[model samples]
Target: MATTVRRTSITLPAAHLGEENPLPALRTPADPHQVHERDRAGLPADMARQIGYAPLRSLLPVRRLDGYDRHRTPTDLDAIVIENDRLRATVLPGLGGRVYSLVHKSTGRELLYRNPVLQPADFGLAGAWFSGGIEWNIGATGHTTLCCAPVHAARVPAPDGGEMLRLWEWERLRDLPFQVDLWLPEDAEFLLVGVRIRNPHHRPAPVYWWSNTAVTESPDTRVIVPAEEAWHFGYQRSLRRVPVPRWQGADRTYPVRGERPADYFYEVPDSARKWIAALDGEGHGLVQTSTDQLRGRKLFLWGNGPASQRWQRWLTEPGTDGYIEIQAGLARTQLEHLRMEPVSELSWLEAYGPLSTDPDAAHGTDWTAARDAVARGLEAALPRSYVEEAYRAWLASADTEPREILAAGSGWGALEVLHGRFKLPGTPFDEATLGEEQRPWVELLHNGRLPTGSLDVPPGPTLVAAHWRELLETAQADALVEYHLGVAQWHAGDRAQAVRSWERSLKAAESCWVVRCLAVADAESGHPKRAAERYLRAFALAVESGQGDTVLGALAREAVPALLAAGRAEDAETMLGALAPGVRRRGRFRLLAAQVLLALGDVSGARGVFDAGFEVDDLAEGEETLSETWFAVAERLVAGSGPVTETVRSRARAQHPVPDAYAFQPE
Candidate 1:
């Protein structure tokens, strides 16, 4: 079956369709008390504290453009359309090179959710994330920072006798490059998606890649995964595995009418064929099939409720509805659990298209039948062996262990920590050491690895701490070394030593991480005042560094308790007020700010923040949302039917039964 594929350019009206609004300048209120003052003997001191400011000025300069513009004006933007005999797909190269829409030509049905308007939400780490379509998320935590930005796109020569659309982007944090190639073979029904992530940096870096596909959610929409169990992080950061289809006494495989917003990560089985599908009652829906390289399939849903409705309305225009996310990840679990080595490339092949099962056949429970049907459909488009071979080659090239790579390349046989450096016995130590030479050691320490791949050695933390102390003798001026040394000490249960090291690290370099470490140590050491001050400093530094909402949220989570314990409710309110409007817009931070208000006995103010936070549409499950204590307090505050002051007092008293300091574990 020879099919012909064609590519064409098209333009569509921008989201607002008829408005021009300029984005506001990023700024925050500077503390009035922060003024220049001299020490006792008329000696000058630096008094301009660098807290409570926006950090996006350097990374994301204000730009005015039509396609994928932040303002969502009526400007027209260019797009690429590729079509075969059975399917049609549109690519928005200007908007993160997203697969804007995919449709079945014969039925005129949308296979991928298509947003009628382009509305950016404060959901991503870098603040702007759009709903609908398929988004490629890589690097950092949560959604990729580039979700709302443009990607390099080109028409590339296809070696497999098809029309290809190539999209590539350089990930800033990891200094790595990744590309996604979409190929539409002549007469083929499925679209071939080939992804390649390459690390050109000198050392290993944390890597997380997920292809987020949004599909229409309906009453009969059932998400089927070829797995028996799914794992999700619970309220206490513990991973819990539950039975597939039904979890917690409820059938999760299908969309229930009144279910709460949930997220589930299904671990792929070791079967020869792997596939995930969203089939409707009528047996017609979308199917995503991939090789073994992609080991995790995630389902995210915002259930039908007040919160979900409000959130959907915030992200899309009126008359438009919300969709569910079917994500595929390269790692076995979440992004926080994966890493990649330098000079290594990861490749995987995925195919997506509309699928129709026999109306008479039982679709949900027949795993073997479903697999065979998917395999047959895929074979109709391309040979299964081709994808298998591609995956095998990728596995062969993958450098699975950073330790092995470092040992083989740098001759740094089993890593041993020294002060802030790795002691490779004969390796020369100098002041101007290259980051390449130092990266492997940092990765080992950062990931908490021991030499010889053995677990019965000396206490890992103590061993690392001793080595870090040794490195400090020579690298005393290095703030990073001091920070890591502090971490090692903290892990070794030496809070006093950790605090001292972090204090020195703070003096050498005003980093968010260092300040945060000091804050935790101070809190645990029973110095609430010092802890509150350090938390404020850390919050300011995180904002200035554009570290995003997670860091800001974490700071708030730790700081609020310390502030309340220190009886500094006024200070907490002031800190919350100082946050930029952009930062306050994030749901996580907004929730924290509301909690701070509740702590200050301002119920109305807390309610306002809570109301605003619900406007952000995000299906991802977070620790804050799962907190039993926080929600109990929030419910009372939102309902306006409790002795608020006593409630706050009680919650505060029960405050942090779990050590809040350990929450600052470096990612």
Candidate 2:
């Protein structure tokens, strides 16, 4: 039996109705210092020789146009539609080529959440990340640096008589290539997403890939993963493996009631097939299925509270009506735990579609039963025999140790293997199992002394430094250790040493964190020009990689000041000019840009910037709105006020304080 796939192009309403989206362009600057290959002693030999240390010398910020493009108007955009008898998928080629929506023909219901408006929020490290649909994230952590950016997309001929939509982009930091192919077969219930990541360099690079699906969250929405236990961390000291659905007196399978948020990553049980689903009370839902290659399933909850609801509204227009993310990862955990070998190609296939339970059994237990019933439906769709064959093939292709550890169980043993490979020390295991001699180091590593983004336990910078040095003696190749060491030094006020440590960290593995720290060190140490360059590089990396909003916002806070101090007023203006008017008008960046305009003697320009800033809606609660400073500056800059003086500008700058460079650390 042959399956036929059809591809057609259609115009659909844009995400941001009656709004404007301006594209920003930036160029990679030439390195100033004549750094040689030998200068990069900390880097892998092959990679060091290939790129040398030239770009490391003087990194510059990206250049933006004089002002945002107001001439361009919003209109219905073209989308590539691929369909079969059972399912139809629509992809927006211009908007990161994300899966805009998937429709199940039998039910005529959306399998993926579709955003009514394209209202990008300050969520991604790259400045703006939109909600809804399935976003393919790759390269660096938090969301691939390109979540809200455009990628090269095309409709290609599939080898199996179906049409394939291919989207690809080259990651700037590591020069790696990533591609995703979406296709559907005739009479097939699911749409398959095939992803390929290739590392072209001669040395291994840190790589991560996840497909984040946004689905409607209702009071009855429940998440189901075929895992007996889950590991919970983030915003807490106790990170342990516990039973799924119900753990530590909290039922995590369903959303909780409160302002406090809950986020956890579950390692899928060793099975022939792995699946995760978000089911409604009616036993109807969306299910994601993949082979053993994709074993990590994560659930994120925003909780039912006033603050969470407000945040939801701020992130998307018309809101998602409330939504949750069911993300599937290729690695055992997050990106910090995974790496891609040089010149190697990694590929995997995942299916997403609608699933429903038997109508006769709907009135049984509760939402939990509905979830189980949906899981059963998925199991029947892909039989055990078929899953077993796929799992065996995947095991054959995977490396030896990871495969063995996964086979053993999903607990500390697998985590120990990954930690040993990455040279990270903390295992979160029972301390009773350790010998007396190794107990103190383990205690220091696992003790509650480690900072978990809390003010209660003031960070032990000195203690952290000592522990990292001890680990470095044994695990010299671990780049993350150097990163932590640099963080400790920066906190300890050894700015020069911190910069040196970050330089070594970059050689081992290039990350945006190291670059950002270097920028801070340069700024605080009185090298404003160098700091400007570094901040620009960090911003470029974030923009290139599609980082979350926190990182981008931090970079803006640091870069604008450094550029102004370096007397690069025009450059500062250009950078601010590139941002979406909405982004530029909010937060500290708006005030900072206005000060720069005033400093340059463009009083009218400064007034215009201030007026635009006032037009934006107030930021949501808990956000860094810097309202006091904005208001104070606004009072002084208003139309009838006297000419602004340097003192007034200085006072405004003091109000909006910059955060510590390492504030946006990867967990």
Candidate 3:
């Protein structure tokens, strides 16, 4: 086939990405990878500056996505295929523009891991991420908040005058517009990707980009990068420089050799081409290379531990072969964000395809020689100069207008375009793209006031950037406006003012959403009792207003936990008991039930919850809640004989180990 772009469909056993949580996500990212003084001492000036650049305080304006369950059903998904004679690439426009598959036509080989199913897990920044495929991670240190969300996709003219698929969206985190243009030349094997992030704002913004590519994991496979040493990070909460290829007692190049999940950020020299590859025993696999702008490469190994294996299973179907990520980014580590100058932009071209080399050299004992061999193979297939030339050639056509729409994304970009009056070419966020979610903000932009009337349910997400705050400040105040303004104030770190605004909103009209936001503020500000009261009140209001089941469920999840934390065991019990059977059976609520029952001194009842096992479908990464809960229940059981102390607690924890089914913590 010549270069072609066409619509297609994929069917998989996928769980619905359920409704986004009505509750706001107010907490900051759990940044466990902070640079230590010892590690920072040897950094270069540019690296140091980028590492210390702006970091996010919270996920603000983005909502959490814990609403999904573990139910899987065969479903059809809309996909777009951009293919050439030698390679066929399938992209999922609805799922963060994820490239789901890349096939080598002549060899009948799949270059990417091609996950067997789509099972949402609590991994993305805002929640709900799945493994495998190529994920475009752009936002904070974690996976992109839009990992499970849709992005606008359209067909545009490629540099070769062939049709190319362009994926673009307005990134809410940094208030920037970005586009990913993917194309393949008629006779080319490499699928070229042109990425551009434009900052239309007057102020500078911190930008993060990581192209995460998951490849099939086999013991015979080895990852090769140009750097001799890498910044290694694991669950130990520390980063240290270590020699690559060989580490500890084993050759770390083999992903399965790792006993625990870890990140090896290759410190690729600025003089070297930015590329990474995972080659098998036969020296055949995927290779990713980009123009010099994307300077960092990483090898993320899920390890062979039970927890790692279980997580892999959780992400897809059982018996599916494992996968590891070969990633490229803008900085040395995901924890760092580069500073994009105001009114300026950053763009880079990346190519992904299969590479083959002599098996002996690829799997050689000499680390340097082994990497050199793969690099030679990559240079032969797609030379560094050729990639640079391609980048330069593609620049001219980067701004070509889209000829047809393949899929539509959220209305956020359209709203942002209206708000900023930004003149973005090539990738347009047309006013027609605006939907119900953007209607209120659209009104605010046109009428200079946020329309307010609906109080039956919770309010939609509120933008918290400085510009939106300024607009709200100038607009008239009402219950709905006040609620949104309070959220914006809260996001700006003005807790006192936020509370006052919510109070004013309450005086105007009672709103479960406003009360819930207040509860969150109080809960974090060391007013657990007040937070509990507010949560309960919010729940009551939700019920009285006949809010959606999702809203009621979300409120209960927060309220019972708050009540229990505040030592209101009876209230917590009552709230937990009042929930419908179906709601109570949700994995999150089941865990809460055990905790609430334990607090109420219903030891046997709590034990019953354990006997009737349940899974917290959205167990967060790095969370040890399952182990902690098990121990807490065990400690309560130990107290039955007599008063339990620290010694008794230790014995209880030692006596009751976390079962295999509940083991998800990195070992």
Candidate 4:
């Protein structure tokens, strides 16, 4: 049977109705081709013709495009036209260095685009595509997205009979060339942006997105974030005397510029509203967001410096650069903020930076003037409506003081020794005798610099283990100090002393089980079977105290090795399976999972986990240590299974190694 497709005839209203206009005179096939050129490089004749261009020639310029390959579509000429509902008409001035424009019939607006022509002196590679055709650049640029419209023309049904256009409504896009506008919505009380760790790969991939925002210029630029903790790594240091957070990254900064070098990585808290802000000289500023519920979030601020050399030289240089980044969820306390939430209505979490071009300028000043820009920005950028007002009020009411004080000048007198940075006054330890994995931190604290050590001190049993030698020499009367001593002793290969110290500490305070666990783990270090049992008990305590994922994650990793060594492979697998979701419930789970799988002899499975982990943990320029470690481990395992080495190697390989003296020096 033949099926007939029904076609409905639609009648058009008069051309004058609703500001509609009749189509302009159609271009006949006889019109000369429009030639718009920018930078001419890699285009070949066959490729050009298939995409509707005549042929690659000296007359046409070429251009390069930037951005991830997440939204790939065929660049077929027919596909572009059909997707945009417009024809790609060419005009004749195809000569080099000329500006070209694309006309949109519906709005009668012309979009100016650039295609640079390469001269013989210039090696023919094209530069990144500018604003006219596609959004190919990595970071945000005001001119990149001059105008935008939904790629799809379908309407989403609202609760009411009327409908609205939405990007999230559709799971996958069909159009080859579609874009959303960048301007703030009219009547917008607040503009919320949410970045998510989207895994397009079959396996889980580490997910990360550089959620860049281009702030308008302002004078007194300053930033404020509701960070209870911080981990400042990388090169440059802040000029001001403020405490920064400690994170899992490179060395801490030396105070220099008005900026602080930092990695913005963080584990998302149970509560969702972690806040960070940036303010100008006049006190007008912008704060990155959080949900109205006021859940705590992680904030990171990166500046131009040697650590971020590539970014400074390539992405965006610091001086006069305007941006403040906040990490809502993920692993490590340093590195670029990784997006870890799903897209939903009201999911923006509501954190954003608001700028003031001029604090002294009167409220009515025109937004265009350079001097009054700050004042104009506050008026144009902030939310004024009731809903926005309510949201801000809710955030203010729920905001809590941050607790993580690990930043600079967070001088932990005796505790610094616990980091394995120095020997106790009466102790016999020296740097050469320390384990390889332990030497860096110890040297760093002794020197008061990074590349030498981590900004963050080890926590949980690891911290306790690292400081045991020094603690053993302490007087028994110092209860709290003795408790930590127990922890350090356990980490330093002194089980009996660790137990004695922990028992004594507990006698002083029953709540000292936190330290006791460290002692017991140390005392039972050789007994993997016993250690696993003790670790489980400690893990339970950690969870009960609501100490957060870091503690739990540490406990899990510690036990996994012991469990595997004790031949409790099933238990280890079960343990990882049970806790993986809780620890890596955000976007960093795959990497954590890879570590677990690698211990289980599932080398292939571990590789998949690593590949997935990279989805969220993209290696920022200076973040190669962990990446290299994983790769080396994977490579070694691939070569063939062998006895595990007792020593763990440092992954911070420096082909272009900076001198020890200048490595972590502030810019």
- Model 4 lDDT per residue over 1-667, tens place: 1111111221211111011011110111111112223311233333223223221111101111111111123221101111122212111111110112233334443222212211111111121111112221111111111111111111222111122112110111110111111111222323332211122222322222123332322333433333323433333321111243222342111112324444432323344334444444454444444433333333334444554332322232235333333333322321221222222112222333334344444122221233234424543655334324534433332212222211111112223334424322211122233454344345434543223221122321222322234433543344444544554554444657767876775566543144426523543446666666665566555555654444455456556656666666667677567564645543234554665576667777876654444432122223343454365454545355554343322221222133321122232
User: Whole-model lDDT, candidate 3?
Assistant: 0.88
Model 1 residue 611 CA deviation (Å) reads 9.4
Determine which window of 10 residues in candidate 1 has minimal summed lDDT.
Answer: 402-411
Which digits, one per residue and each the tens of the lDDT, describe model 1 over residues 460-506? 12223244445543443456656656665655456688778778866
By TM-score, highest first, what's the ranking? 3, 1, 2, 4
Each prediction's TM-score against the native? 0.59, 0.57, 0.97, 0.27
lDDT values of the candidates? 0.57, 0.56, 0.88, 0.32
Supply the TM-score for candidate 2. Answer: 0.57
Clashing pairs in 1: 3-186, 3-187, 418-467, 418-471, 419-467, 419-468, 419-469, 419-471
| Cα deviation of 464, candidate 4, in Å | 40
Query: How many clashes does each candidate structure show, in the order listed?
Result: 8, 13, 0, 69
**Candidates in descending lDDT order:** 3, 1, 2, 4
Candidate 3, 1-667: lDDT as tens digits: 6799999999999987889987777767666557765666577667656667787888888888878888999999999999888999999989999999999999999999999888998888888898889999898788888888899999998898888999998888878889999999988989999999999999989999999999999989899899889988885756778988788988888998999899999989989988999999999999999998899999999899999998888888889899999999999888789888899989999999999988899898988888889889898889989999989988998889999999999889989888888898898899898998789898888999987677676678888999998888888999988888988898898989999999999999988998898898899899999999999999889888988778888888878878988999898888777778888888988999888888878888988898889989888887787778888888888878587799888888788767888888753
Q: Name the best candidate (by TM-score).
A: 3
